[model samples]
Target chain A: MDTTQLLKGVLDLAVLAVVADEDGYGYDVVRRLRAAGIEEVGDASVYGTLRRLYSSGALTSYVVPSDEGPHRKYYGINAQGRAMLGAQRKDWDEFAGTMARLLGTEGGA
Target chain B: MSIVDDAIAQDVRTYAAQVRAALADLGPEHVDDLTDGLEANLADALADDRRAHRGTLADEFGAPADYAAELRAAAGLAPGSGGQRTGGAVDRALRQLVGSVRDIEGTTLARLRATRWFPGVEDLLVALRPAWWVLRGWALAHLLLQMVGAEQGAFWLPSSSGGWVLLLLAVVASAQWGRGEWRTGPRWGRVLRFASGVLALAAAILLLTLPQAHRDDVARAQGWGDRPVEDGVVVAGERAFNLFVYDADGRPVEGAQVFDQAGRPVTTEPYGGDRWRQQEYWPDGAGDPLFHVGVPGPNGETRWNVFPLHSVPGWAWADSGAPLDVTDEDVRGEVLAPSWPFAAAAAVVPWRTGPEATLPAPAGASTPGATPSAEAVPPSDAPPATDGSAVPEPEPAVP
Candidate 1:
């Protein structure tokens, strides 16, 4: 199966986790995700997720001027986003354990 | 910015605009929310793409249209939702129809691709697309000319200079449109699709009618159709059914074989008129007859070329509905001939010499004069041409 298919279900959580670490502009967040090995993450998908999170009040946005190009819009995780991310992380751990157990690949189950 | 950076910046702006245009059906707030920082995002991405020596903006991000679709999906927005509130019921229905038709087309294409030889067929169809574009343009021009009553039956060539210009412009425009040189909004895109469907139907109709129209043109050029065919001899624009030939002594001749100067037999079948069959003839008081029948030749061929053709009173055969046999002795009766218009026509004497042409005189007159004397009139006391005693005996069979 394509990894991109796997990425879609967790893209919102991934975006929230990335912003929760530190404030980053759109491209900055995408670069961090790629460096963290989620290389198949699409640029538009990350941008859209950021916009959706900001609109839903889970993320806050602010403009940061740059001399190189247009002003960059940066996103940061708020309290709502951190709470959501904590719950999602716990859910992910449980799901990963269940999958590993089912596939008989966990170290000690 | 440096010149190269400026060019990159321009590219970023153009790409951002394309993405925005793709999302044009969304409400203003929705579109603004989606595309607020698109240019800055695109600029940073393109710079990295350039540094990495990757493909162009489209290669890095896919087409702007596809990118917009992904954005809409990822943002949890339904496709075409934002534009629904602005459209009327009919517009929405039409949009649904277009979407359904597109879905069906995609499904059909997918099914066809599964067949072994369909790929080759599809390739052939793709190769013929340009030809179809040209033909549809020509068909549109043909329809326009036909509406204005200026068509002259040629498929490839228009009749007038104005038509030629129009055809050229339409073909160029159609080819450009096929090549996707012009950008259209979502609504205009649907309208263009509808127009193309209508043009396809018109092209099919023109294909069927072109051959028939060509045949009609050929018939008109050769002057053969549209008039009833006239057979046999025509005198003063009226068909002469049977010839009435009179001897110099005013006796009506029967069974005279007439011919033209070229010795071609002048067959007097009189296929042009039905009035002769409906006319009443006296038959010289030999009782009225049911119908008339022409006498057959010795070889049993009805001799149409025979003058004052010998006709007899006849009845139809009970079994076949054909005229009663004239050879039968019991059925043979008095020959029914039409009454002659003159008893005895006046005779004329030929003049030997004249500076100016002088008219012939009556045979009894001494001088050749133009004026008619009492003797020049036809004699009323002479025997009628239709008299029963004047009937001649049948000549020896010539077959």
Candidate 2:
């Protein structure tokens, strides 16, 4: 199955989780999500998710000046983001267990 | 930094600009909010790609347009159309029309930008946008001036100081509008943008046709040189076809040349009002030779200044252009004579035929020759000739 199609349903939750674990800039978050096995997640989608979270007050951003090339904008998850992530996590776990049981792989994995 | 790094930065900036352009229909502030850190994000992504030994960003993600769409969707913004579909039929139709126009415009711009030189040209155009704004304002001012029927002065410039003030205000307003300083709601902003487009088109058309209008005015002004005062003599507010001269005896004088106060020959040649009659006079002739043909002068030039210029009736001339001898005996066609006002004007000085009957040195510059044979001389008691055949006593001796 294409993970990209699956990633769209939980991109917001994934971005929030990644940011809560460790506050990071745009590319850093994208790299972290890829390393966590969501390799098909696009850069633009992650960046857009971060912006949306910031706009909705679930995340806060600050500018970090860099000596490399340009200034980097860093985003950190807030309490609202963490609470939303907790709720989505519970729902995902329940949904995954129901699917696993239906497929008769409940005890195999 | 190395030149390679500079090239990468430039590529990233170009890509970011393309993304922003895809979302341009959104308000400038909204677009800014969406694409604020776009360049830095793209640069970071490119650096990561280089370290990981991946292909270009385009290969990894997608085209800029698709990226912008994904961004817009993920950010909880509307699609590129941006119009909500919760309206009535008319609103839907209007939105459809606007969307179609936007689609065509975007497609055409994209095609143009794909050309080799178009990006540089677009850069130049973007740099010249302020100048265009000022010109748009000037055009709007001229349009208003024309609408109010107070159009004056030069074509590209306003006429008066007040006009200049209006132009200045319009330009400032236009520049402010271009810079997004005068903010409006979405609907009103769209309406104003459409109105400005129409006004700009009208101004371009006006500017293109200005030279033709100016030419017409110049032609009309120059036409004043040849006027009625010089064309045909008007007497008592009526067009006088022929001028008759009389001697001291109150007898009709033949072949008397007339001139104005300035020694210009006074002729009735130009008053051929009926083109059909002129065609009858000289059917296939090119020039107005018949117009100036009357009695011969000393210099042998066809002078029209001869008084009471004799003319054979139009039908008297054959197809060969020669006047046929049409006397009272052989009147084949109708001999329509000119409308003569009087048979003989009362002479100012009475005739003293015995000795000192000195003639006023012939009126015009052309020297008078021997008297012409009187084919249709007006009698003393003759009434004003209305139509055909004024000569009651036609000389059979005339050939």
lDDT of each: 0.66, 0.65
Two-chain DockQ for each candidate model: 0.16, 0.16
Q: Which candidate is the best by DockQ?
A: 2
| Highest lDDT model number | 1
Stretches of candidate 1 above 4 Å error?
A1-109, B1-85, B111-121, B152-162, B212-229, B234-399
Q: True-contact fraction for model 2? A: 0.42
| Clashes within 3 Å, all models in order | 0, 0
List residue ranges in candidate 2 displaced over 4 A: A1-109, B1-86, B107-111, B152-154, B160-162, B225-229, B232-371, B381-399
- Model 1: per-residue lDDT, tens digit, B1-399? 689888877777888889888887785446767887798878777666423545577887889999999888888766775583455678567655754564465445545655788767765776687998898788778778878878666465697899998888878877877766876654465477677788889989878887898887888877866566744778798655456666766656555556565445565554311324432334444464323345555455443555554444433333344544555655444444544444444554545587355433445232323323222221112234543444432211011
Q: What would the TM-scores of all predictions be? A: 0.39, 0.40
Q: Across residues B272-321, which tens digit of lDDT does each residue of candidate 2 receive? A: 32324442233243232232124434343345576665554443345665
Task: Give the TM-score of chain A, superposed on the true chain A, for all candidates in the order listed.
Answer: 0.92, 0.92
Model 1 C-alpha RMSD to native: 22.8
